[model samples]
Target: MKKFAEIDSINIKKNPFVVGSAVNPNKPEYTIYLLIKDDYLFIVDCGYFTNKRTKVSKWLTYQLEMPKAGLPWIVNTIENKFFKLSHEGGLPKDVYHYAEVVDGEKLMIDRPMFLGTRENPEPGYEIHTNSRKEGRTPKSLNFTDSFLFEHGLFDLFKDVAQKIESGEFS
Candidate 1:
């Protein structure tokens, strides 16, 4: 199969084109590919199941395509968009929410719970991103879940999606 970097041109009308990719700095087994076709975005995990014959893309390739300064805003904007979308669906506005706690002698803070299981009882892992959300509820529209955050691929995915939406990458 063709690798992402080797793609020089794409017939987006026919198929989604690879816009960028990210690899987990901590886990080599985690990698993601971002693609766009028309106005929709798609992310594919090409990390665990691949063999020697399965082509993969590199995070460095995506970094090299854009200026370093663009990363922060791109990430923030994407997070904001995700937060808003989730909020509209009755999901919490915060992908992660912090709660304050008190110890007898000292105040303490708890780390934010990411898409806490309390909100959605079914396990997230039970459904692949490729599958539609259960009940096809409005919440399903908030498809970009905490998996991207936990995996450190959220910013990369957002940055790439922003670039594609801005017509900076086609």
Candidate 2:
């Protein structure tokens, strides 16, 4: 089996290639790869996994306590929801709704996740990003910057799907 980095070129056609790197469970780096298979094309973002954006992430950030507890929670949340599609299905307009807090209490308890840095954070995670609401929904359009707020979260499910598909992922 070849290490993913050396794979070089994807046999798929038209699809964007996906690349990812991780050592720490929290902060995994991701990128997109364009691959074309049999005359068709697709784009795969690097941060395709739910638990971490890259491979062997949890192993790298082996805090023994925090990373273990936090990884599962974050991964589970993304897998449960989020939507993604190609230029064909068209990116869902409601994609941003993902960051919406479905369960306030349970969600809040896991605030200090190891993935996103919170220590001495210049722009602390607590402050909501007013984004991702672009063409989001009537419920969010009223907010001044809601469209941009959820932009980061909009890809929750999308990444997982891309990661799972051997046609795109492997």
Candidate 3:
């Protein structure tokens, strides 16, 4: 994995290569990987069942090859849904909407939820944990840390995506 940028202590990296699941779960688990090449930004979701893997992989490859002209739509969609203000000191009942079509199938991106209190604020952003997976035992690769603000992770991701789309960084 190539390091891209570190936002609010969260390191964004280029995961061009597929990685094995950190935890084995009864149900298929999902993980999102971010990558950038020149002016293009790629977002990949891994861990569908074997039956769905080929289709998902094809979709991801197509998405990775998409032109930068489509990036604005992605950034705007995420911003509108992700940057909304929520109730303080708790996870909001609202969920951010992010969906992509692959082989006519809709695949939704999992937006990190808000967690913890004002004094000990925590955003539900864990890159190496399979706790979010359904029917999976809570397991962590020990990659979690405390964060303040309801939209901390969302804001960081949005900012980086926007910057990359604008060609602000090489």
Give the best candidate by TM-score.
1
Per-residue C-alpha lDDT of model 1 across residues 1-170, encoded as one tens digit per residue: 11123222223223346666666443366445556544334444443434556675432211012222233333443445334566464235544321121111111111232332455532121112112222552111122245556655565656664665477753
Instruction: Show where candidate 1 strays beyond 4 Å.
Output: 1-16, 49-78, 81-131, 134-154
lDDT per model, in order?
0.38, 0.28, 0.36
The residue-by-residue lDDT of candidate 2 on 79-135, one tens digit each, is: 343223434342355443334332221121112222234552221121121221225
Cα error of candidate 1 at position 24, Å:
2.2
Per-candidate count of clashing residue pairs (backbone under 3 Å)? 0, 34, 0
What local lDDT score does residue 160 receive in model 2, on the 0 to 100 scale?
A: 38
Q: Could you tell me every candidate's TM-score relative to the true structure?
A: 0.35, 0.21, 0.31
| Top lDDT prediction, candidate number | 1
Q: Which is the winner by TM-score between candidate 1 and candidate 3?
A: 1
Off by over 4 Å in 2: 6-77, 81-112, 118-149, 153-170
Error of 2 at 155 (Å): 2.2
